[model samples]
Target chain A: MPQRIGQYTVATPSRPALLSYAAAVGNKEGDGPLGSCFDYIAEDTTMGRGSWEQAESMLQKTAVQIALKKIDLAARQIDLIFAGDLLNQCIGSTFGLRDFGIPLIGLFGACSTMALSLLNAALAVDAGAARYAVAVTSSHFCSAERQFRQPLDYGGQRPPTAQWTVTGAGACVVGHGEGIAVEALTPGRVVDLGIKDANNMGAAMAPAAADTILRFLKDTGTEPGDYDRIFTGDLGVIGSRLLCELLDKEGIDLRAVHRDCGVMIFDRERQDVHAGGSGCGCSASVLCAHILPEMAAGRLKNVLFCATGALMSPTSSQQGESIPGIAHLVHLRA
Target chain B: MKPTKKEYDAMTNKASPPSPKGKNSVFAFLIGGAVCALGQALLEGYRAWGADLETAKTLVSVTFIGLTVLLTALHLYDKYAKIAGAGSLVPITGFANAMASPAIEFKTEGPVTGVGVKMFTVAGPVLVFGISASMVYGLILWVIGLFD
Candidate 1:
């Protein structure tokens, strides 16, 4: 069983080695700063699918296939798969990974799904429940727009605070073997700082990220300087700044080590991605493609990867419900 | 930690990107006028081709919708709409965009469920109410004419 540290923190006694991972991105995301790190940059966003949702499903399928191939593990070898996406009922994951023939636990942590899936997979492996497990999540710009916001052709004007949903998929294979082992995990509470604006996701999610980070630090009895880097999920520029401010208020300075996947994924000044890149794919693809390689190369030793999420549906937003945010923390050590 | 006023001010003062603006009506006016001018030009062109006034009017409306859908597919209309603001919502083009945008966005769901279903999400309500109101008005007119 996974050891419970304090509150929501879990210490996985049996370390799980991340065997291999793969990422696939759409054309726009392929042009971002970490573009080349992705395993596949699909020329067609549709991936030969007739619809955007189907394309997203295809993206997840391709990412998992590549990840399994990287480790030379056939689909049947994997015991279980954890997958989710920013689609209604998570059809993106369900329809995408159906042929894998692995038992799946579909998850929904909104944009924070990447870390949530990772943490769960690590726990399953740590508990010796599965010999090999796969964790995957995806998001598509077109599909997300169709579901959460106005359709692309509506000619709706995007505000500067709005982030561009990354059109990509990322998958990882975890085993109770040698690799980057997960040190600890912290599940976030649904924090609501009374933010109601859906477009300003960074602001809405920052409090939750800060809340989880503080909880993780206190639970592990560690300091901000203990980790080489503290990576937050798609908090974008505004959210990152806010997180720093929130940490500073608690006397926990993260000036040197703090970095967000949102800021690192895109060149904000050049790319028209307003606040920054966001979505499940944002952190998932970045962590899988760029950060894991850095860990493998022995560049980053101990790192804190905190993925934040906004849990709000269109109906809830219409009902005037404030956006509730959650952040899942995973401690990775090389 | 309960921060003092000075510390709070210092902490929150980090430079970030500009916030969304609330005013852009002038740009909307200018761009909307330009869109309207294009429609007027199409109307005159059809008239010059010896089409009747009613036929020319219908052709102008159809041309505006067709051009809007084409620009939307080319991924240029959103940028134009962003700058134009509410100005781009000039009835014909705006309505066409409202219909075409959802259809194109949902096209990935498949033809029957994705496109066929969501295509009417926006336009369906408009068509239902529009045709119903017109029929009601026509019935009233006929009722009054029977007395004459």
Candidate 2:
């Protein structure tokens, strides 16, 4: 059995950080907007399949700059890169970092991009793959929404279970640390709910979240009450309720402090956030902006972040349409 | 000698009169429009095929019911519900369309668990209320027949 770091071992080597690189590439207000930022990740209607690559690179550049500012380290000093996003070829973030010349390895896990990136970066440090490893993931809300279903201009009113996408980028650096260290890896497994209805993503995603969390608990031998907080990526209101209900049925009650980023982003009354926001960027932005700060502040010790994502393709959805959701878990010990 | 005058008078006084405020104005208008539009469309469409008035109305209602069932099964009506919004809820199609949405949602675990049983998901609740209300109405009419 892997040595689960005993109590009080984490001192937090990485500072709670925010990088300075950000560009709102889509059409929207520059201020704190209620909804997501990117109106379109990439214009697939106009830019062919190649456009996804361009959007991905842009995300990567933004991530690298922000990460660099947090560490006062130059791009040349960084040795390894673990970048991810919802798009293919890791286009948005990867292409953007190409000019920086870091040895970039691309990853994809929908909204769980950061968690996936973190697991890889942490492994690189743990296994001595490199001296310094950077983890990056980005999401463009508009691009995802348009690609998944219909164009916003088409006047599509999303269901109460539907979620809004976040248009933002986030990155983290997992280097050799004497400070707070990567504690555990609760490897995520794909649990197919077999839900064919694209309209009802809540039902599709809830069971997957339950399955991954249950597996993580079983494998790590961590009790449900072991951690103070357990977070899920984008299981907004509908998915969250179902997750609670399903897990309760399995006799695994999670934290009273359990929360989802999708439900937290907007004031539901003011923004009319329907079900909530779900996307790769939703989890990434929240983890970087909110959860990291708390971790740095020593406000939270053990956080099991499981970012949920739907893996169905547009072609798949169009043909008798089914949405197969997957969730990935990352255990960050502070 | 069944009851004293004062006792009978007290019982009658205890019964409160029903409020005369009209039912939901918006709901009434929407439902009325939906029923009339569906009824008219069916009659006109069938009249082209030389059907009588009564037969055309029945044909139209049946046609509407059939389309509703197909859309309900394929889950196409739920898609239309997104675009149509409030308008979709106005018609009989809305009720029928909502039938399989819940069933399809629960159907992922397994067929016997999700499909065979869940096929009655929303419809079960709806039919229960519908039958119960109609039974009450029928009972009132039956009691009135004795008086006649």
Candidate 3:
């Protein structure tokens, strides 16, 4: 059963387990620092698909398939699936998982989709609403570029603050079985600090991450030293630094325990990714590929996964609206 | 206390690395000059092949557009533009690429709704402003003629 903890945290007494997980990434991500941790590295960005959208769909499908195959579970055995992507209306998840015939709940948390979906799936399983649930999310560089910025072949110079959208997908299965335990969760509130630059999303999203992490630490009555690692989704270099500075103002020093998925995914100097990797896939793949596996291998005992997202559309940004950011936190135990 | 929005923006600005304007300007000047020099060479070549001055100029522009489209298709122009920056962007070749790249990207949507509709998305603004400015100049010239 799940019970409300102090303020925003929810404590799952049963601690729903993550049975299996997998990550699949494109060539660029496959060539990154954490490349070997990924379950599948597609040499072809298209995955033999005609369009980038279809390729993103294939990424999701491959991730889900690999996750299920590891646990020896069929689609019919799973009761619910929560999935999303950085595509319009989440077409990547909807179209990709359509063949599975499982009951689906579509989510749109931008880059925070992985944590959002996992939180929901864990809650559902903890409450006995489902026997097994799957959480998945994906993002593609070409698809995101076309929709948000410019055409694939457009030759506009990128600013130093701009982050490269990762081309990858990650999926995880949650059930009431022995595996990495989902102990607690904290869903973030929307925080908008009037950040208007679409290129500098790290600045936009850092405040939200700081807020959620503060609340989570306060509610849980634990210090940064309690957790082996605290993972933030796709803050890159700028946001990660800003996050530490923001938390330092409140006398909470996160410098020692903090690690960002965006910063971990790429080799900053070797890769042309200016700030680091952004997008839903960045955190999702890192969690499924690196974080969870580390926990399963007994290397990490306690971890906090906080994925942040900048919730602004192209139309809103063009209308001069500030980017609102959100971060969802999940406390996992080995 | 948490910083105000204005304060936070300032902090973010300070933390972010500034774009290398001096380096970019040097690259732009060299690349842009080279592009102009190539156009001159092509124009001279066309003239030597027995074309008039007007025909030679037209041929040079046509050749540049053709070459740009080919480079864009081969996915090589963007890599060049990454280093060349405005050097590649301020040329007629850039205008041709602006039209061609979107056409190629959006072709997945369909020929009519995708390629045709989006073909002018980037270059349309330049055409609109350029023609309007020229018209304003012509109107001013006519007013001076009337005064005379």
Candidate 4:
């Protein structure tokens, strides 16, 4: 299975600067973590204001479009499409792809959806499910807010824990037989920490991600120090420390390279990126844009991306409980 | 010993199993079930209203938020939640009620962590389920693809 890193792009409902500002504001309370977190190739400014459903569709389409432009493959030529976004219906993905005429699969790993989608695409190619696949997911703060929190225009200052939704979308296409490929991967196993609070997704998701990354490294006969970088979807500042601490508890110390997409998106204090976690777009943009380009430029070699997500439910919460969380990994090699 | 406000807010979700009185449990159940029936009708009616699915969900959320807030103000949300159980849940309004109920109970936890965090507790489950389910789905696809 040739996992061609053919193309990647990011779509955000927030302007880059606003995202920057939000991140800075959020980070003032804490020391930040991670690298060029929210950087990506293309951006879509034309936004739709409706429910999360409507906004997600526009954002998803924007990302897929940019990725397609780079690959220049017709919709029919594409073997399959794998996508995810932070919407209830996977709206950004499904509706955006409604007219594309390709077999569609919608996924939602929250902030980890980008990696989750990419992992699926890689498997599709490696397992001979398809020749070429499109994978993308978007995060719209407005839509997310409208759907989950208050409305878009609802005037409220976000707390330190709240993250700026990258008004950006990211995507990449994996095609069989050539280009910078995803050659070897250690698929991540899911773990639940049973931390049901959604406000602290970083805490909920970190343990799961840490557990899986440890397992993948062990099962594959690989070491954490083997990769040039070990990264997760959105384990912001607080969760990132907890992850490192958790890893240490298991007698695995990753002194080499560990990073987080959430922690990387903005400059701390300057960007208000308190504790460093955003939606799926965080890791998607980093991997698809910064990391992939760095790999293409031969500045980087093998890397690991462990995407994590929290799993909670209204029924569970109303019943007065915490949420469960999980993580998945995709190791990419040059 | 009784719980403090913070402890109460935290433990409210972990309510103990009821210790029934000798004979009135059935009557209480019937009355509770009947009230739940009315709320359900209104919720279903709101659901059936002419609107986009997105709009309808928002309407439902807002309606629930409004109703829950009203109930919280009137000190009824906690009572209803106890009586209705799953009935209080199952609807998006339950999310509204969750936040407001905790706010009422834990107002002493200070404004930020106590009230703010409580606000998200209701919606917290949505994030958790959405994330976990998707990751599982992603894993399933990965495993299935290996077989293919």
For model 1 chain A, give the 10-residue run with minimal summed lDDT: A152-161
The residue-by-residue lDDT of candidate 3 on A293-316, one tens digit each, is 999999999999999999999999
i-RMS, every candidate? 4.1, 19.9, 0.8, 16.3
- Cα lDDT for residue B28, model 3? 96
Q: Estimate, for each residue in A77-149, the C-alpha lDDT of model 4 and write its tens digit.
A: 8788888877766777778788888898888777778777877777776666777777777776555654455
Q: Which prediction has more favorable lDDT, 3 or 4?
A: 3
Query: Model 1 residue A75 lDDT?
Result: 95
- For residue B60, model 3's alpha carbon misses the true position, in angstroms, by 1.3
**Model 1 chain B worst lDDT window (10 residues):** B8-17
**lDDT of each residue in A206-251, candidate 1, tens digit only:** 8889889999999988998998999998999888888888888898
Docking class of 3: high
Q: How well docked is model 2, in DockQ terms? A: 0.04
- Please give the lDDT score for candidate 2: 0.62
**How far out, in Å, is residue A333 in model 4?**
0.8
DockQ metric, candidate 3:
0.81
lDDT, candidate 3, B66-127, per-residue tens: 99999999998888889999999998989989999999999999999999999988889999
Clashing pairs in 1: A51-B108, A52-B108, A153-B101
Best of the two (1, 2) by TM-score: 1
Segments of candidate 1 deviating more than 4 angstroms: B1-26, B42-58, B107-116, B123-148
Best by lDDT: 3
**Could you give the TM-score of chain B for each candidate, in order?**
0.76, 0.60, 0.96, 0.51
